[model samples]
Target: MDWDKLRIFHAVAEAGSLTHAGDQLHLSQSAVSRQIRALEESLDTTLFRRHARGLILTEQGELLFEATRSMARRLETTAARIRDSEDEVFGDLRVTTTMGFGALWLAPRLPRLFERYPNLRLELMLEERIVDLPMREADLAIRMKEPSQADLIRRRIMEVRIRLYASRTYVEREGLPRTVEDLVSRRLIVQNPASPQVRAGGEFVQPLVAQANSTLTVNTYFGILQGVIHGVGIGSLPDYITAGFPDLVQVLPGLESAAIPVYLAYVQELRHNKRVCAFRDFVLEEITAHLRTIAPASE
Candidate 1:
């Protein structure tokens, strides 16, 4: 029940080694071990399984760790909220989105964010998995589909399509695929079936992979973009990326998947958090500005 003991336990669980946790806490290993033992005795439950290499969480430890993780996130959110000023947006804001959008769209525009809010500490989590917004796995998320998570404020950003693209050089070298039938003779670059991807993208890529004579599978959209840019082959890519990457040309112009909506979401408790508001505003503004430049050409 002691806050200090919970903090120490959280640190040790995260580090997976008493000595490492002690190093972080600036306490001797013996002192850290004693505290852990005392805490376990108080709880009357073993929290960790001792091993030669390091400790592993027991069932009870896992439950406690989850609780502590939530506690830590809530504390951080509270601290950030308290630190926020109407005049300045400064503090940590963890943002999650798919790897493709993070690497292809968001990452490049981040410099403007830093320029405006120099004190902001931004953590960009680029993965396909949905981070828990209410649980504070991340402060905000830009996702390909509407988030079903409760207790969140959600905004629909825009629609995107998965379509084939190839470099001009590749098209020149291999000739453009006039139809899905034409794709049979050319190498298809796609996200690997094993990798998590948006449903639209998976649908667009699956048929290409099945019909192509040769195929190259990359684990992420970033890798697929690299392959397409380097003249590797035609690829299944998000239509949004074409706005940033000028060299990529849409292949088989008639072919693309149904529109998928992009959404930005945050916990309702963060409604007044300056950092989250700033980021949300910046993203909405950027989308508006870029769509103007991209629309005429994209159409």
Candidate 2:
């Protein structure tokens, strides 16, 4: 029947009264009651039972309510998609990434994006927390972990290798750790000691002693690399961050290593947006081309 009648019926079912539904829909109370009456007549069923305070849904009304809710949700999603399509793509591109990668790698590369699209603005949120893309918390994100949800589209950018490193001065003073057992006694700068993934074997690398006895504890990879530069204790750092540093030497070259996959994620529906597509392709191209030069050879 009439969509407007169904709309009014849905509103009244939700609000429990004609007056309340009228207030919500910005219609007169009489208009709300008329629409509900028409809908009831069209359906040939008594949708609501009259009560002293308000109305209560009948069994048929309850069933209709569930179906109507689904319809409303689908309609709202479709309308939002249409509106987003009609909107211009010259707005800000909000991106979220880890602090270390954002600062050390992506921040420097953003100049090219700005140069290409002078009209678009870029806002970077550098935090470890994964921002919700479908909720519009962020337009895009570069994450170290693979996404578990199927609603978003994920593209693997590259395979990242973590290498243990120390400065030449530290190596000379503390003596280089030739074996994994030697690493246990030596000082180490850990990024996140609390992380289960950071543990090698049964012994956890204590950053406090590693800092006091050897170097320092830092949360970001950039900070760890800097600590290693100033002759801090040995630390594990991503290959991309330490690529150009002259003083940082690979510690325990073959014995100890961990590799993690990096991904570029975005909402599946937004993939077709012109600006989004352009940025996605550009990033994919850059990462694919540069990964060979920067990524460490797989062990």
Candidate 3:
């Protein structure tokens, strides 16, 4: 199989027009068409059918499309690894993390990472949205949810314990709740549910609060934590997030604690690549060691 012809076929299938594909690949439309024709000839099957607007993949093309997509991803990963190997381990390491984790945990610890690997350049992208790893949007991600993609590698870093907490001022003013029923009478700070399960939890938990009206509703957990810090209302926050805050008091200690698993995800094939591997192992070690230092004796 001619890799160049396959590349042209992939570009055409993706772009849906020879002209657009040619523009992207910096080749003439005629050259792109020729390559596609050669690929079809070699395969002895029609790959694409011409449409009024663009080209549509034929049934044969659909099968080839799947294989070609995988091939392209592998090729890109291989090329990136080759380029990385030739250069110093000093290139940018793009990381995506939730705002709370990045701000309270990862960001502070990054100085140590830099001290260890002085040559590695770090770019931290803090967001609530999970960046697309396979698209090369991010090199690594630390997320609350498990990645469902089979092509990506995922490791369970640790289980984060989330508990309802309030500032000392709020607790003193509102009076500490003796039971879950007491929560129903006080103001609550809540985060918008990122998943259906979290929404269900919110629905069940909200009824316990007396006011039912949340003082603040934000998309990110960090926002919820910040609101709690300013005496907004009782909010559920991860232990790791609140560990550094001196004034935050845990409310409903045992009843409100929920365990959420954290994960580290990256491209599967890039697992063996030197720089990627180094970062991956470094993160695992840092997070696991941190957990060990803070976790209860039983944990």
Candidate 4:
């Protein structure tokens, strides 16, 4: 149970090769191998199975690796906490959100954040998959719905609705659909029904997709937005995007999906982190500004 041996074993298990692990740890391959052997002798267990490709963890090694991974995350959390004890809002902050929102909304406003905190290192993970904040997968998350996870500090940011939109050129050529029934003959551009999306959005588009004469389905809303903007067809897009795209006209203005609530969340452990607080405040301020900008038009 030597801490140094455990550290080496964790690195080797992660790399799956003695030489690669040695390179990462700044130790010679032979030295790393010797340490591994000594650790195995002390534990009286074979931790890995060597093959032509590399080392594969034995069942016992897998269990040990899990523990080490948890330890590593805890150490990182501790380090982050210590760093945050300073008054400066500067350090690595990992934020996760859906690709569409990250690309379409948050990414565009990031310059303002950097202008305020030049030393802040931000890692934006844009993916459909939800990461585990409690496990330290990410420092923060902006999700389409309230998070169900325990020990999370979550706040509803805003509500978005899925509504039909078309570029000016497309509307000029094909004309607007006056009724739900009028949509039957028009080409529809939408997010693929099977893609990871909010339930309200998928439900709103399902009947439209079935009734359309032709369809273009993209997995991401950013792609769907592009298709709609370039005159591909009328598309179902979140209402939040319309302010950024003034040229997009509403199609069937009365028809809209149920509201999808957006939430910002982080683990309770990050409650006092200045970096997290700064980013959260920035997002809230942006949202308030966005709502105000769109208010006059909506009214």
- Report per-prediction Cα RMSD to one decimal: 13.8, 12.5, 14.2, 12.6
lDDT of the structure predicted as candidate 4: 0.93
Q: What are the per-residue Cα lDDT tens digits for candidate 1 across 1-299?
A: 98898999999999999999999999989998988899999999999998988999999999999999999999998887787657887778899999889988999999999999998999999988998898899999999989999999999998888889999888788888788898899888898998887778788778778878899999988898899999988888887787787878888776889899999999999998888999999999999998898788667
Candidate 2 residue spans exceeding 4 A from truth: 1-89, 168-175, 195-215, 295-299
Query: What's the TM-score of every candidate structure?
Result: 0.71, 0.60, 0.63, 0.72
Ranking by TM-score: 4, 1, 3, 2
Ranking by lDDT: 4, 1, 3, 2
Best by lDDT: 4
Q: Model 4: per-residue lDDT, tens digit, 99-201?
A: 9899999999999999999989999999989899999999999999889989999999999989999999998898888899888888899998788999999
Per-residue error (Å), model 3, residue 196? 9.6
Backbone atom clashes (below 3 Å) for every candidate: 0, 0, 5, 0
Candidate 2: 10-residue stretch with minimal lDDT: 195-204
lDDT of each residue in 29-50, candidate 3, tens digit only: 9999999998999999999999
lDDT of all predictions: 0.90, 0.75, 0.78, 0.93
lDDT of 3: 0.78
Query: Candidate 1 at residue 236, lDDT?
Result: 87
Clashes of 1: 0
lDDT of 2 by residue, 1-299 (tens): 79888888899999999999999999999998888878889899989998998999999999989989999999997777557653334557888888877888787777887777676777889988877888989888887888776689898887666678899888778888777667656667766655334233113344224434444567677777777877767877777677656667788776444456788988988888767776787788777656765555432
